[model samples]
Target: MFLNKNRFFSNTDLIGFALLALLIFVMLPVGLDVFRLNLFGKYLTYAFVAIGLVLCWGAGGILSLGQGVFFGLGGYCMAMFLKLEASSPEATKIQSTPGIPDFMDWNQIAEIPFWWQPFHSLTFSLVAVIIIPVIFAFIIGVAMFRRRVGGVYFAIITQAIAAILTILIIGQQGYTGGVNGITDLRTLKGWDIRTDDAKVILYFVNGGLLFACLFIAQIIRKSKLGRILIAMRDQEDRVRFSGYDVANFKIFVFCAGAAFAAVGGAMFTLQVGFMSPSFVGIVPSIEMVIFCAVGGRLSIIGAVYGALLVNLAKTTFSELFPELWLLGLGGLFIAVVLAFPNGLAGIYKDYVEPRIALIFKRKMHIDEDVSKYDPLEAAAD
Candidate 1:
């Protein structure tokens, strides 16, 4: 039933996006202090991951449980560049090896690793942030979707990949900084990112990038490829038999999702000042999926809201009631599942939209009757 649906943006979509723009660019910035605003900026990074999930899981029916893998990869890429810049020989003069990163010097590594060399160039790191995730996602998508392996099997495989990456990062202390992960990141290209001014600037940049992703996702969701994805989700066998290479489409969308996530990761590194395996593991990956589900997997805009609201709640609850925070989160998840499967967007679609449509219909009917009854009409004729 949803396959033939092509209406991209109703009046509802326009209004929703407008409000989101206002909230991000004006309301939050005006209402909050620098510290609080920076926290919101951190939340906005997660919105990138949520937006990706809207495309891959919502529109394309690919439930990837390892989004954090891409996010961490992108963040680590950016962090490596920043780390190198911050670890210049002059900056690290106190260390025994005055040119290497602090962690490496502490770990007694004699020289920079070969793989870390590429990240010394900002241009290369930026490209790698997007390309690396796309390649990794493409490999996984091809392996699974080609053989018709999907559903829960696909989810499990993605989760396992997340686990393996976390383990590897933790094990390679000499390379990855071990359980401590990457820390002490201070500057970017000689600019002090820890300053209040930089924080505000980064927040705006993060918001701008998020909206760009949203626009791209909307275009994809309304295209012919989008319809086919829905078709495959509902009936993969039918789509394949109809001569479509379903696997190829799945790979494309999954890679697209990973790219979105990579951007978020890089932004997280810039704004939050570190990258760690803590973000690339099972807990974080699952939480990222929850953001999409709560936002309404089918609705791109809703996913953004879902991420912001969930993260906001997590911070507030954990701060106010540390012991009860998990309880609150569990209840929130249950409420979303049991009460609103379609999420915030579903509520708008079912209740709010109908009222708006009814008002418009009534206004049109009144205008038609008034036109017919115009007394000046006869005299003019």
Candidate 2:
């Protein structure tokens, strides 16, 4: 009966399905609690960023060091809308302070900047979260990929972009919120963001989004485009010679990855209820890369696991040994890299595959002996 089923339901598929089901079941209960739920939501956001890294660095061999730029762009977009909604009607009319955010006061600015106008609408801000990062990535990808820039050169360029973005945000005191980024967010769509129910709902939403992303990533990994991406990663010059537009592919993936980061950023803003220039700086960008590396860059599941594990450790270490948190994290990274260069996913594979293979081998040996030896021969032996 089992043999009559579709071949696609192999051992790996069964195991994967079982694991996913378990994860959902376990998360459902934890998500019911506000604090744990919020923590999980944060992890989901980090998972989204890590997934973007998986696509760019793992699949495309493009190490984007500026993912935080896209993340910050989306975060600020949502933050602006929230701020606009939170402001009083009378406050919205004053030219200098009209719908002016609190940060303007810190900068001693009297009026709202013209550029902050479009973000007044929730719809526009949401749309911009997806669009702005994509557009930025498209332009950057075209320029760099067209010039055949990659590897360390590509990484360095992206890092510079992140650094510059951070500086620009800090310098643009009035508009960009300067050092003390957008804060004191009270609500979302009139719902008290600080309430426990809202937090649980957010957690469920985050879990759903994480699952959806995993499904989409799995589909992409199995599709023809995924194969092409792997081909590009393995031999870009050969792929170009084979009539494929390598530049276009690279740009597409970059833009897609950026969009993913933007989504994560928007969601993160909702959970954290604030956006800061520091969130988009070089250190955060590097941290995103570290999440992907610690997870297993090539595997989406690995990325999720890595983000959760790393963030959980961060929280624990910070609570228990605040001063030693960075040291412990650094040591953890070094240990993972040395032990399983391919990341935590590799460790899982190594542990599972050999055990499964051993079981199958033992079963096969038993069957072979049963078939080869007659009852009389066995008795004589």
Among these predicted structures, which one has the highest lDDT? 1
Model 1 Cα RMSD, Å? Answer: 7.1
Looking at candidate 1, what is the lDDT of residue 200?
Answer: 99
Per-residue CA lDDT of model 2 for 63-168, tens digit only, reads 9999999999988888888876676556446544555676775567776677778877778888999999999999999999999999899999999999999999
lDDT of each: 0.88, 0.78
lDDT digits (tens) for residues 1-381 of candidate 1: 132234676455678889999999999999999999999999889999999998888877889999999999999999999999989999999999998998898889989999999999989999999999989999999899999888899999999999999999999888988888888899888899999999999999999999999989888877888878888887888999999999999999999999999999999999999999999999999999889888888788889999999999899989999989999878877988899877787776666765676677697774433333223321111
Runs of candidate 1 with Cα error greater than 4 angstroms are 1-8, 360-381
User: After best superposition, candidate 1 residue 311: deviation in angstroms?
Assistant: 0.5
Q: Clash totals for all models, in order?
A: 0, 3
Error of 1 at 195 (Å): 0.7
As a TM-score, model 1 comes out at: 0.93
Model 2 weakest 10-residue run by lDDT: 372-381
Q: What ranges in model 2 sit over 4 Å off?
A: 1-14, 90-98, 360-381
